[model samples]
Target: MAETFERLPEAAETGGWLVRDEEAVAAQRGVVWELIKQVGQNLTQGVSLTSVTLPITISEPRSYLEMVADGWCYAPIYLKQAAVEADPVERMKNVITFAIAGLSNTCVVKKPFNPIVGETMEGLFADGTQIFCEQVSHHPPVTNWQVLGPGEMFHFYGSGELCASFRANSVKGHQEGIHCIDFALDGGTIIYGLPEVWVRGVMWGDRIIEYDGLMTFHDPKNKIIAEVKINPEVGGWFSWKKKLPTDYIGGDIFKYTSDPSKDRSSVSKISGSWMGCVLFDDKRYWSIKDDCPKFELIPADDPLPSDSRYREDVSYLKAGDMEPATEWKAKLEDLQRAEAKIRKNYCQEKGINYVPV
Candidate 1:
């Protein structure tokens, strides 16, 4: 008797829509498959079984479409899995377990286990048996996966709750300085009758190298399933030092000038005639017009110069010095009399009274 088998919809006609561009869809599928294969190979080579768990859960079925002249159809299905572990030694194992589980689940839903692809059909096995399986039928299709951001370069993806929280914090520009990782699993077909599984993990070291616009994920049905608009909030750490001039001055000297010729020599000179008259009058010409000698000669009998009265005036102008008696006595008396007369006049004019305190 011949063995029975179920036939899957061709990769180009898995979905109802007719694929117009078959070559493009095939190319995309090929890229996706290559990435999935690389990831699987890395997991198998890097992970050890003693310290890690297996058969981790994955979320979201990967799907793509083949465009036809009239419509489109779903293609072969792709799947993804992710996991996290603090210990470096067990992290690879965790990732591998999830990847294997994802592959096995895809096969169980789409086709029977083919021993030719290294899939086994053992009813029951004793403990400590290590089974290795390979599948030639597994082909992953690729799609564009873009990262959007204005925050730290890294991210992580896990369970729905955790992803929601991380996304919220990242949008707010409050995500801590940790790496982010994102896995995009996409293919050309949708498997029927399988419950959508929940996927969650700790992703590290993900960054946005270039962002054209918003981030989006589409299923094979051409429906927009997930979208995150790009509104990059600003955040970072920075420092600066105070800048000061190398030299500083305390006060302006121009305000204290007393003589224009001597004081203003430091400034540029301005020369011009005012009202149509020349300003440069020679000393010789002025003396001749005034009928006076050009220079005066002092007489020998001149009295010794005495400034006793002006001495007190000079002292008062000096801001903080005692006035001489002979110079300041008369001035003080006159000031007192003036004050008395002003007070009497003010009292009489106002017709008001006040006792001296």
Candidate 2:
């Protein structure tokens, strides 16, 4: 069984408290809440910003001296500045209102354990215009200690009403393994407002991840545009490799060479691991040396092989001239039909719906 915790009021106005004698914890939560609110305020003004929330949950054994920090942190500005441009009244009302509601229940966990570290999972959903998000983190503690402070904040647009629910739970025992889940949802609509767009925000360490809603413009005079449904799932595993610095070389291939004016350079100087894959068009072309390979046309109506023969055929095609556009188009159609058939067969086999976009 999991131990349940009550949802704290918005930390922005009334300061929140969970564990007693933890003034620092409460202050941290309050600051985070205010930051979330600020982000919401900026969004309404057509500003796209990214933020991070760290260590949503924490637990551990008093003897181990092992600390586990698990929570949401992301590092990418999700929405474009152009997505929110509209009348100031409508934008402010919608953006600020949405941020307060959206940041309502984000979870942060920080605990100390041994040998095993903690993990987190996060996701977002959009029902046409409305957007929602959830984050979860868990840890096992050795000594009995009450959870002190945990807080979260979600942000969205103000054109819709804010009706979201938040929850968090924890448990411990001799058994091993930690589980956590978080969710957020926004619903309602505006009769005469700007077009709807779905937006989701996430935080992972110093990185911020966002799934900005898709837009389709329709009217030029009214500047009417509709945002499509967006479902984005963002999470990361705790690993030591993440701490290591990458050795990637910058700029195009020419920048690393001895001569800037030369069109052809020595290929051997390009020192990096090379992986090859086949490209599909009218015909198959296998990539070699990260450059365009030769092209050959395959019979469009023929069945694609299930064995290594597919790679062999691709290699053979790349040894020839580029396939004609007419042949390529026909082949593409055949490939699409084959894909549809495969999907249908798999859905029937698994007793699932065949929903394709």
Predicted structure with the largest lDDT when compared to the true one: 2
* TM-scores for every predicted model: 0.14, 0.17
Which candidate number maximizes TM-score? 2
> 183-210, model 2: which lDDT tens digit per residue?
1222112212211222211111121111
Off by over 4 Å in 1: 1-84, 108-141, 146-357
lDDT (0 to 1) per candidate: 0.20, 0.23
Which regions of candidate 2 fall more than 4 Å away from where they truly are? 1-14, 17-86, 107-123, 126-357
